[model samples]
Target: MPLFRLDASIMPATSQSRALADLVESEWSAENPGAAVVRRDIGSEPLSATIWREAVTGGFAAEADRSPAQRTALARAAELADELIEADAVLLAIPLYNWGVPAHVKTWYDLTYTDPRIAGGALNDKPVVLASVLGGNYNPGTPKDGWDHATPWLTRVFRDVWGADLRVVQRQFTLVGVDPAMDRFADQAAEIKAAAEQLAIEHGRAIATQVQSLAA
Candidate 1:
């Protein structure tokens, strides 16, 4: 059975981003029965700053000491990387903040991608799908909304560093104000939520199907 990792970093349950993440998880569960679904709530377990410091220091001996905090950080990073390595597919539910990914999500990426062994080895050839929820209308060729810098950086990290095939399935500009709302505001929100969930299921099935084909 394939493993599906859902990364939810948003603080509020009511947050559109968090909602989308939950929706994706639900869809994956429904479509991939008997599959292992691991939900990594980064908001609940924030990445330790000590790890960030150690990551920047680049000192082998410092990391070798295995200070309690450093050890925890290393362990978490290793666990997350191992999970990614074992999974046939990855889905990142990202919400735009200040025109970029949330800080917690970025930290998650930093932790998972910085490990030289995992990034350079087992993570290669994995397939990733990015599901983004944006408050404003942002796409290519618009003044207010253009290519998200975070998307390209993420693409490079997975492709260049991990040698993974990353496909972006974006649900862009779901905010009601930017686009025309339905008769009722709640109705529009529901429509957007449903669409996002459908995309997530489709993405999950696509990855599973691809993996099966490759195995065959």
Candidate 2:
């Protein structure tokens, strides 16, 4: 069975981000019963501060060249990188924080993209699907809409650093008052939720079908 990795970074369980993630997982699992689905809740397991530091350091260090704490941190980062490399597909549920991805999600990307061994040319040809939920409406040519920084940054990282072909399906303008009336917000949210689920399922099926084709 092929492995599908889902990373959810939303702090609250009922957060819009988690809602999208769950919808994706549920729909995909329903379609592919034998497939392996693994969930990583970054808010709960939260990467250590050292991982962020190592990201700043450029790469991991030798086992014997560091304190026990540092070694453990390096090991965790390596494990995450290995998981990413081994997975056939990846789903990232990103929620906006101050006009960008949450801090932990950014940290995860930092760790994922900084490893010289796992990165460089190794990530070539990998496929990534991004599901982003934003609090405000930033749909091109609005007053507050100009502040959207999530998709662009994600696209650059997936293509430039990870060497992956990335597709982003997003749900934006979730916050109240972003639109004309509050009533419309509920409708839009529900619509976005449905769209996100469908996209996730499509992404899963597409990746699985691709893998099957490769094996043939």
Candidate 3:
């Protein structure tokens, strides 16, 4: 199956999430050689906030009375929806930031609603892989336990609202070598990082397996 990947990290070249996503994409590409890997980097070139506003406001306006801006917004919404609807499965690589969802990530979904296919649930059964990265550990018993608000929300949007079969792979303690304060945990962080990379490769294979199983 063709792969659709979305990267939502502001650090285009150096994002941990993107690096993990690269493993999945690389495996998927190997499995389905020459297949198109459709991608959109919302972190760097996000859909405008204005586009989302126009889409929402234009929804209430009469079709014939809508302004040119509304028309443009509607057009863009359709384009985004097509990307989702056309894909058999998708991989969304996002990072938890400031304990919440990134603005660009939220915007992507809010605009997804503007398209009837998504809002009306026309595209409800595709499988999805959520590959997320976080700066610090928030696992159970950690001080920051339950502090993550992004993963659960993303889960709802894809699995519940959009009805996509979903799987998640997360890499935490990503700030180990970056922040000076976490230097003490550096050794443990390296171990976690290695494990995360191995998991990424497995998850990538898992997607290909799932898609092939569906075909069978």
Candidate 4:
């Protein structure tokens, strides 16, 4: 079985989201070793704004009638679509940047949306692990309550639009050491992070069992 992992963290080694995702991969691999893992780092390599225009133009025009730019755009769309369509389980690891989903993630969705091969029901209820890391808390009663725009938009895209079966593992209050302004909540950050990591490991185990079942 193939596992598709989409990592949208700007930070490399120190990225909490990516670290959690790696745990997931490791747990899943332990269950079924040698499974192929496909990695896509959208933060480092983002889809250009021009891809949208190309995808749109290519979508409207026939293959033979498409311009070189349009063809390239369509090809890019296909690349993304095939990743999800071919995966047994998907790990969508992302960081909430400025209370919003990363620009590359949105652009990726836009590009895939225009492609003909990847339709509304393309994923067919594929299991998706939504591992999200947020710098600040957005839970109810918090100062930034109801301020999260990233997870919601992703919910619409992964659940409503693509019909994926999503399991979200979110870590909030993550700006403990980075932003001096959030120094007050620094004390609780370690505990919160540990809990999230444990949860991610559990979900990863569940995913491994689920994927193996599907293959059986």
How well is each residue in 35-65 modelled by candidate 4, as lDDT tens digits?
9999999888888978888889788887799
Question: Candidate 2's residue-wise lDDT over 30-148, tens digit each?
Answer: 65577786667786677765676754443445555666655555667777787777766666777777877667877777776555666665667766667678876677686666687
- Global lDDT scores for all candidate models: 0.65, 0.66, 0.87, 0.87
* Candidate numbers sorted by TM-score from highest down: 4, 3, 2, 1
TM-score of model number 2: 0.82
RMSD of each: 3.8, 3.1, 1.3, 1.3
Model 3 local distance difference test score:
0.87
* lDDT minimum window of 10 residues, candidate 3: 120-129
Q: Write the per-residue lDDT of candidate 3 for residues 17-109, one digit (tens) a residue.
A: 999899888887777777788899999999887788999889899999899999899888898888888876798999998999999888888
Whole-model alpha-carbon lDDT for candidate 2: 0.66
Model 4 C-alpha lDDT versus the unseen true structure = 0.87
Regions of model 3 farther than 4 Å from truth: none
Candidate 4 TM-score, C-alpha based: 0.95
Clashing pairs in 1: none
| Greater-lDDT candidate between 1 and 2 | 2
What C-alpha lDDT, on a 0 to 100 scale, does residue 133 get in candidate 2?
80
Per-prediction count of colliding residue pairs?
0, 0, 0, 0
**Clash list (residue pairs), candidate 3:** none
